[model samples]
Target: MPLSAARTALGSATAVALLLALVTAWASGTARRLKSGVLPIPAITFPPGPAAATSSATDFQEPYFPFLEGEVATASVSVGDTSHGFVVNAAQVTQDARLGILPTQLARGLDYGTEALVAMLEHAAAQLYGATKTRLWLGNVGQRGGGDIDFSVSHNSGRDADIAFCYTNWKGEPVDPPSLVPLNGQGQAPKHGLRLDAGRTWIVVKALLVYPRAQVQYLFIAGGLKTQLLAHARDQGESPALIQRAAATLRTPVGSASHNDHMHLRIHCGERDVLGGCTHTGAVHPWSKLYEGAKRLRTASVAATLSHGEAEQRRRALQRLVLLGGSEHRRPMAACLDDPASGVRTAAARAIAVLGGRDDIKPLSARFENEREVEVKIAIIQAIGTLGGAGAGRFLAEAVGQPDREADRLLRALDTVTILRGPALLSVLPDTAAALSRAIRTARLLDAAAGAEPHALDRLGALLADRLLDSDPIDPSRLVQLAAIEAASDSRRLELVPALVGLLQDRDPTVRAQVGRALRMITNFSYGVSWASASPGTRTKGLQRWRAAWRRSRGAPRDAWLITGFKAGGYQVPRLGQKQTWELVRAIAGADHFSVNAQAVLVRLLDHRPPSAQWSKNEACQYWLRWIRARRQRYDLDKPPVETSNACYRPAP
Candidate 1:
């Protein structure tokens, strides 16, 4: 498409996306506070003493709102009853667990209590439902890198949160954001919806009522919340009871994750979840549970089969098992791995992955190596990964060579190397690199000796860096992974320096480019300690390599050549603008060791059209939709506006 036509298309998309974002960005208006995009979404900066204590939850007096570009400003949170107020740094919200766009509430400070519940829910797994299911984080809040959200704040409260589930892979990565609406309760996470059953909603509410000091305990959420929480308050202290009573009065509107990103919880300090404090609460009246028929009901014992007619009867039972982590059934999740039914066995594998101990390693390994069925093997790998450790890594290594192995499986296997960063996980590296540091040193050995504790990482690295010594058309992902090895460990790729330098001239641009980026990182890490003091030859070589890569780059230079360096895009970068030029732009802008892309990345977006709104009313659909839409617009590939030879134009910076 012509450049002018591309600009027109991008403008249309931008208009649609922005309008939808403004319209659907409502739930976030009611959800709660957030600290996203606050102070650059980078690694946690450690304070000199005791991590600077990171301002305790109680220290939050006012809500935090980090400046988009400037320093995060703070306020004092002073709830009427609490004489002492805490200071809330707007910048600190990034670390807080509640990642959705929040809405406003009548009473303030109570939202923090709601955030506590979000944190726990963020940790919930299918095990909580007695299913060996793995969940994925629903929204960008739980994403590794930083992101922007269209958080709409009404009044002073922020209650929107867009959360999703995370499925624990064979790497045993953490899962967050359970879904209220799944895609017909299937595995296609993107197809999910947002309709939350009332009972499940009640579980969320009751959980919050149990904690006090959480000013948000009073927010009116579900109609049934007050009654449920009041019953829980029976055996608990008065403070909890007061909080539950306070939660009974809040009632408001909510939208799906589309525009707004979180489960908006508005806190009214003294407001009850119900219209009036439910006086009819005593140990949560079981009388409300009316069985449809005696024949349908099982005996009042664990021996009796559960009745499927009661709707959530099965779900609640599963929740019980999940809470117990297979303890309720014995041996954590071990029993399910061997279940006769494939689905049952699959679920068991997932649950056990999250709850079981190292004892599961051998069994999960056996299933992974020996299981004939691809699905079962995949499940087993995920279970081992979820369980996490050296065992998982070993299992992944063993599975890597299976015929026609799925790429997903390979990635899972590779992911195990970095997960948890525990000794059990690092054991997969060659030369016994127990953790990141050891992985670095061991990977440098350049020996294929299969001893002392060498693992697949060593094998893969040795094959590419030392063994495959020549540049060839290797699998792109493998090459990309090799390029990434430098980041995985701290060791420099000097041995492969010559190899990487040669790749710049290789026919395969993808291979050549990735090699160049990796090489840049190696040079940067080496210079950090003594760049200014390096020998003339070493400095010259580094400069010469950098200049060569920059000159050869088809598009923008990479950040790996700069301060942070390119980590590479994890998922398919959406096509932006009419011609969808991101791949082109990334190739050019990401050519250097600096954030040279930053200077031009946004400019590219400013030049393009935005995406159609993905905001849906259903919870799950809304969340994913908004994320896709917003991210698309923000990263639009249209050339950004800049001064040129003549008039302004959007294209290569």
Candidate 2:
């Protein structure tokens, strides 16, 4: 035979030999001995043959398969935050063509998930497609080891999976989507020539809810698609029980993608997995089997581990207790505050901060006095601050006056005052104001290059604003008064405008300048006098102009200045000068009094909003800054703002 023919004969013989081996294994019931459900398939042994020299016997082993019984042998574990978590013993979903589900990004290897999650997906897809010819497309679940995946914030764990929405043509014929198709409010994907198949999608959702292997936690879908699916289910006379479950599970996830093109499903951690470091957040639905008994068991197990386990284990246990969240765990957590391991003590302090109440202030303060480790002491202070009360405020007030206090501790104490706010800190303001004033003076005199106290001045400014602004007669020190004025601008203390105007004639030129700058920042009026460089006569006239402006504006609405040029149509920078426009932009980007309102006006001008409403104030500001930087020239102050796309801005590398 020719060489090519011989090669073809060898390949044919190898295939035949593998087929015979599988048949023989099945006949002998060796495959039957394997456990059921979605699991790693046991390696199959093949008889040595001519082809074995070229191909390893392992090549003939079957891929993981969903078997007869839906019980997982080794439960998969999902641990830590969903965005930064990892999974252990994750099961790879079967990729067989016959399963009626296709991996959207196979090369990325993001198809692994917990056995329960994999089984749920397989079962749900089978139930949907078994009655019809339509197919389901699966997106990312997690990587093989179940950590971070690309373009996702919450698929780090095996519990979350993304499955594409089922679609149909205008004629109602099933269409296998090549990828996820984004749909508009009317459930139509006009660009793709497809409409959402609400009925088929409901079937898959129902199966996921009814699946015995895992409890559905969330089914994230766009609001419009969710509405259509629920309406179709009700019209079809689906049981109210199932419909209600679907309604509760379907949501538009906050702080992440809206999931408009596909459904993002998350499953609750199993009871066994919970004991092994898996975590579940949000509400536990009534249908879930994880009840008080499971929680009690988990709590007890964590307590035991904290008592006997190593430092890392005890730290993890403390974290798990915080997640469990009950008053019962408080005693154990408080006890861990004295653990030999500083890491455990730090973890305990943080846990107490989240789960502790006002009563926890005593223990935390006591720990702070004796804790030698700087990190542990900082954590205790933070806990006491977070659990702000009269007692906490008093403790923090006294701590701030300590002559040898570290910069970080002082900063933290100041932050706690801000957190305490209103009555808690107000009742103790006299002592706090005096201590903070001294600290501010000391901080100023320190060498600038210490670098260990970065942002100390800024923090002190904010603290002075929060407490000293309400003082009947504000601090006498020039530095303290100056700090308060600067802070008022950033904090948008609308009520402080009169006091700021009073400070316009202060002896110190720098304090007078800051007050002028703050007034302009608050009310968006410069009054034609540059306070910093102005002569005595110009300063006097400018001060008069500010007083007149304040008198005329005092009776108006408190927020009138913030919306001075804002109309139903959009924001118009009042003067259209480059300086005015930049001032407005700075307010929008800075953590000032009207930053949020500024951001809203900017959003209106651009016809854009952040993708998720859950973005922090800082995140939103950073996003606007990036957007403005990219299109600075196009933003003509004289013209009406142009509309921009609603797409989210990706963070710059």
Candidate 3:
């Protein structure tokens, strides 16, 4: 079954069951807060510590938006057996009698993964003679909820697993208490009273490589241990091809702590997970076909499946055709653009976009006019954009000029513009200034309609920067410029800062105010001047101050560029233009590393409840601060505030 279909069915049934349960509880007068799509909450009953001190269901229910820029896990974990994959019990790994717990308090033991991979590794280890009969000790995979595991950075999802290296005593007997003995030059642990179980370790490594369900992307280990394992495999007469794969998959990861103690196995996102919105970073590979359900289907078979299979099968077939990419499949793939099912049509449109030519534009445009589904239309527009020619460019320009078009369609038009303006394509069609304005407006609409994507922000910045640099005297409207500035600010891209700095001296006061806001968003430095009240000389001084600050911290070795201390003569930010200014201030004040003074100011703003059409900003900030303070009081007070959700707070910096 397609996991997407199962998810929908299960989620619906669960929602109904939960509602019935709530109704029963209400009849008994036992229900308190009847939250939407969630069971009634009793007080959190987990043991009182950082491990158990997670955000409550009620807390997440409240409106607060968290800015998450890193390895983000969206939506809830799928409802099913966690062992098969969606495990919610953080205590499961900790309490498992089979696994030995490390003494490190940082290890919360909440890792989850496919049971198939686990079984394969265990069975492989058991096959080795004189191997330790003890259960494998495991490390963090992910929290039960599948967000960032506090102990490790990349274990946000369930695809990562860490297994302890097998170690033996001097007598060549497996030890009860596991130990990490560094391998010597001769692949033996000489110093400690332990030795590396090379034969047994090789078994586990080979199992990972051969697992049907799991495609190991990287088996991170120490350089010496990797060398030791490869040598052992070669010595054992392992096939050169298999040994090559082992070497390719096993290597030291960049910017990670040395993994001499345990092997960190990172798996690619399963095909099922991809259908459920799991995004895989980096390149796609042939192994992807295994999970995509196309490993056995050749081009003819896939093309046949695309024509006669179920909608899902057709979708998968289209995807496989894309991966199998060849000129022979283009005609069949293009036929899929008109597939009855939207999913199939979407896949077909995407494939066609990659393979189609100028000759295909007319049919795509005709489909665009007739298509009812928003996603399919977007896909068609993208296809048209990718197949850019004079005709395709004209079609996109015409769409852009449709003032009465739906916001979603306008957003697609903006996307089409971005593609058309790429390296291979000519200039943005119709007019550059109009295109820039459309992009800014379209971005704002998309943010409200579907939550802004990162690419939209990039397009907005690029268009505005181009106009600022070009000889075109047609400056964008005040609203357009402000929208561009805000989009750039939200993106947190420092490269956009250089382009925005020039706008600080623009004649429009709103532009100057927004420019200042964008700069402050990128770099927390505020040159002691006000956009609304500062004279030309004062603005220049402020600009100069910001330039100097940017230079000093331009290439600073940090995740984000933020000032630690306010310079001696730094400008104290005055009250600027309404909602945008406070939004910026609220973001800074609620940031993970915002100074104590800034936080205190945020408290004041929340308490005072500033006057604005968007009153939720004040309420949202207050709710966030209240949650943070309560959480801090219960747990570690010094830990920085993190984005729990995007409802009431800013995204990660």
Candidate 4:
């Protein structure tokens, strides 16, 4: 036989042998494909509990642990802008003919790490930006373990996922049992990581990293996670120069023998599955070294892991390092203006706004002019909408006047606008009018617009006036709209009278009759002013006054509605129109001239207002709001000790 022919025969036999082994290994396994799923970290035997109550548990479900019975496994992928969700049912996974699969990479199995990353990112985005940034895939790509030679079998049970960077050959396609061609001898799988454009991949990576739950794994760094560590070193712990140096090294062409394109991510698994000979006992790997290398490269390496505090602390620290002006990544705060990490950018924008400053204007405007992430851009627009004063207002008006004024940024700008009665509002009134004429019931947008311009009643005056005039009466749905409009009314000084006065003569019997209730909105405004404009310092004064009030008034917020005399909007607003309830509360509470009234009113707003009515001030509303805000404060304090009762409310470390 010719030498070439003999060599081909041997190679074919070898490939066949390996394929047969994979088949034999799982010939009786579940027929369905597994995708997205979450795995929680098991309680560890520590010095009682977490090193710090907030410290995240490093381990997850043990393989011996079982998953909930009959729970379906599914996954999906992000193919550009859309997130496609899929359930693990009869999926026609193409074995050959170029199946690009990014399967689970967890070594032990999908565990808290994997699940946490996704959730953390989502949480961060929502916390930072108020929306979820996670992409939905056919199902979540996953498996039981990591460090496995066969690329397709998702063996690791916890925190591991695999990706095919490139498609070289196919396996299970010609039939049920698929096979991957060996990249080389010695059972070294061929480099088949995902193939993606570079900068975009970084965006995805950033999004995952920002999630509080995520912990990323880099498969082929020369020094394990040296490269990874180096990148975040300056921000995470290393110095700037060291990080830059590491960045330079990563930019260097890493020898092709290693996979560089696609990443191997490990996630949390709901329970452990010990099917394969996979185990992560004492095998946990951290990206510590890689981060260090990058820090050394950037000359910014230091000692430490992220320390927990309250949300505010983390926010401020991240801001200083990522969002604020202090860190080298000054643009970090600005990235969400057009970021790919779903919600990171949004959260960044919101945080920047709350940490209010004149310094952010230029960067914010730049993002407005150049941003592309629809939601991120909108956030930027919204944050800067009312923040820019007259100059920002003019620019916003002009920018908003263009076609497609309701684009993401435009809509977001409309959402957070504060100067509703002024020139900026007047400029956008045309669009607002058009929105209302079409009966577009976007409660948030409408409420924001109304609140932004107190004279919303003036611009929308005709609509209210007409509704009042309708003899047939506006339906319940329309009443909801009216309520939202009324809620937005600032009722400043005297101008509010005409708008309400006009509604009094409305033709609609409902509008005419509801005038009394609507009149209460004016009083609601008084409550808002007395409460909304107060200072934190004035709280003490209010408390003092409250202490001096008749003891019976202690329960006033809960029962004040006894004073109302007629038809109700079904939506309960604690003191919607009880002017005396508001005024007397402020007086009795002896609140500071500037703030006690405000605190009194806030106490009234216990629960969130009804979706449409915008009249949310009440005890339940106030309590819940205070609770969330306090929890946020707890998050800022390195995950403070929750007095057991609040355990459920504590955020992830």
The lDDT of each candidate is: 0.30, 0.55, 0.47, 0.29
Give the per-residue lDDT of model 4 (tens digit) for 1-653: 33233222221112112211212222322122211110000000001111111223342211111112232233211100001000111112222222223233222222222333335433323332222232212112332211111232222222433332222223511121122122231212345421222222233344444344333433322233234434445545645654443443332223223433334443322111111111122123333222333333321211010132233322323322211112333344444345444234544554354333446767777765665444344345444532445444444443332322323222332211122222321221211222222111111121221222211222223343332222222232232234223222222112223344344333343343333233333222122212223454543354344234324343443224222211122222334333322222222222121122233343454332222122212322233333434544433422222332242233422
State the lDDT of candidate 2 residue by residue for 533-599, as single tens digits: 7888888888787788777787765346665623211444463334344444545433333454566
Could you tell me which residue pairs clash in candidate 2?
492-593
Backbone atom clashes (below 3 Å) for every candidate: 106, 1, 17, 168
Q: Estimate each model's TM-score.
A: 0.26, 0.46, 0.41, 0.22
Q: What is the TM-score of candidate 3? A: 0.41
Candidate 2 — which residues are off by over 4 angstroms? 1-75, 78-94, 99-112, 126-135, 142-158, 165-175, 182-206, 217-261, 272-290, 304-306, 309-313, 389-615, 618-653
Off by over 4 Å in 4: 1-331, 335-347, 386-392, 399-616, 620-653
* Model 3 error, position 417 (Å): 32
Judged by TM-score relative to the true structure, which candidate is superior, 3 or 4?
3
Worst 10 residues of 4 by lDDT: 37-46
Return the lDDT, model 3, position 168.
Answer: 75
Tens digit per residue, CA lDDT, model 1, 597-624: 3223323445532111111112212232
Instruction: Give RMSD to native, each candidate.
Output: 25.5, 21.6, 19.2, 26.1
- Select the stronger candidate by lDDT from 1 and 2: 2
